[model samples]
Target chain A: MANIETSLKEAMTIDGAIGVALVDYTSGLTLGTLGGGTTMDMNIAAAGNTDVVRAKLRTLEMLGFSDGIEDILITLDSQYHLIRLLAGSQGLFLYLSLSKSRANLGLARHQLRKIEAELEI
Target chain B: MTSGSDPYQSVRDELAALRQQLTGVRGCVIAGVDGLLILHDSITGFEPHDVAALSAGAYGISRTTGSVLGQGAFSEVTIRSKDGYLAVYAVGELALLAVIGDSGSNIARLHLEARPVTQRLAEKLAIETSHPFG
Candidate 1:
């Protein structure tokens, strides 16, 4: 299994990736992060996005659906933010932000799924 | 101390269990982020209150550093002195777990053993007072 650092580093190699982080939605803590340079703050984004995850889960509970979220997509004017809930780890997720101009949405999603599969923590 | 019906017994039990799992553990304390002591299993000479307060200070600084540097939320902080180590772990959003270990202690192993305990302690200490009458 890929360790947290390696998983995060691998995530950064995805096309048009601006930043990535592995966050604990329960406490809004990032286990590891990469990219998100001067223009974007990966850490802040990681913590802030926990609310989004929580809200979605709450909605699922309210609806009494036994289903799981595949991923969340947020399209900004110039960026695409993706949040993928990792399996086998409760309250954990992988967050990726991509440059809209450079990213292929379908491929990014596929790459993230592959990375999540190998992630150990 | 009474075992059953004691609201804090589970906290006490967790501290004791941690000591059993890891060697060179001089002491352990659970404190609120505001610096109030929740419970502790410490040696005679150790000062838990002061340690709790200092731990709170350390947590505050470390969390701020993460935020300012855009690194993310504070996970834990470890300070190694020549004689021993002081490690502080965040317990959910409400409390901190501080461990004092001897010089021979393995830092990485301590982390592996202690992290899950913090999660359990958070669950035990969580006050379900949302509806006192319910």
Candidate 2:
């Protein structure tokens, strides 16, 4: 099983990986993080993303539907933000922020799935 | 609070379990639509109140997003950060589950696991509200 730290390191190796962190959406805290530099602030970014996760969950409830959320994708001019909720770990999720210039959305998604499968936590 | 027969109990229990399961997760909380705390299992620096407030904020954003898109309703929302990600899913009319994780977490799988529980809770709420005995 891949430990959280190793998983994070592997995630960084992805072509466009700028920074990575393991966050708890419920509390808006990062359990682990890697790669963000002067250009980005991982803490602030994690906190804000917490809001996005909460909003979508709220919307799902109000709609009176029972389906689950798969993943959330945000496309910016220079970045692709991907949020993948972890299965079996209720209230937990994975957040990936990639540089559009170097990341492949399709491949990133695929790789994330592979990592999730091997992740112990 | 309803009596022993309260149908909302199931929903509450489910949320509690979710909180427990995510014991290692930081900055995550399960809350009700009214911003009341249902469960808080944060492993980071945030307070329970802060998590609740963030959940409320997400609810507001979701409402606005629904309006703009002309969609009948909103389901889930996600925000990405340079170092982490936040995601929220609607469990039922009475509850919402929010998660904050690092960029390495698998959000997609989280959603899949949460969906069934949310659906079950919603049904229990519906039945309890619909029946006088409940």
Candidate 3:
């Protein structure tokens, strides 16, 4: 299994990846981050996105959907923000931002899934 | 002697008892919703003030998210780090509780023990606010 650092490095190799972070949605803390230098602040984004994840989870609970989430996608005009829920972890998620013009959504999703599976803490 | 009117005597006792009852708990802090520290156990590494403030911000966001999404209300949030866990719970409409735990901490036990503490503290805070001069 790939470690967190290795997996993050692999994610950067994806087609349109601009930045990526491993976040704990429970506490709104970013464990590790890569890229997103001048364009975005991964730390702030990590905390902000925690609200999104918690809101969705609460909705699912209210609706009686016990099945967990796999991922969430937020598409902006110039960027695609993908949040992949990691399995076997406590409220951990992988957040990736992509340049819409350069990214292939399908491929990026597939790659991120692979990375999530291989990621070890 | 510090006046017996110290509003937080029971609150302090509750925090101390929580630490004594649990293993791996590093520290605990009680703060106002405005991010002001009310009481804290001996916490190392990070500043309790910073933790209190950030936890307030976190609580506000979570509560709003819960309400706006029709999920009712937010009760608590738990953050797991590489080395430990940080959990924040709403003490009442006006305050919050933040607990720091080590990696080996028993989270289930922490929740079981901490939840009741919040309730008792909430009641105490309500009384304190209603009788500032009592």
Query: Which one is best on lDDT?
Result: 3
**Model 1: TM-score for chain B:** 0.90
> For every candidate structure, what is the RMSD over all alpha carbons to the true structure, in angstroms?
14.2, 16.9, 14.7
What tens digits encode model 3's per-residue C-alpha lDDT throughout B1-134?
A: 12476667888888889888766789999999899987798888889999999889888888898999999877998888898988899898888999999875656557767889999999987877777463
Rank by DockQ, descending? Answer: 2, 3, 1
Better of 1 and 2 by DockQ: 2
lDDT of 1 at A68: 90
Candidate 1: misplaced stretches above 4 Å? Answer: B1-134
Model 2: DockQ vs. true structure: 0.04
Q: Give the range where candidate 1 chain B is weakest over 10 consecutive residues by summed lDDT.
A: B125-134
- Which residues of candidate 2, in runs, are more than 4 Å off? B1-134
- What are the per-residue Cα lDDT tens digits for candidate 2 across B1-134? 34676445656666556545442334556677667766655336667766666776787789688989898565677776776667776767666677776665445444544677668766765666567754
* lDDT (tens digit, per residue) of candidate 1 on B1-134: 23476667767888998888766689998888998877789555878899899899999999999999999988899988888889999998879999998875645557767889888877766753232531
Candidate 1 CAPRI level: incorrect
TM-score of each model, paired residue for residue: 0.51, 0.48, 0.51
Highest DockQ: give the candidate number.
2
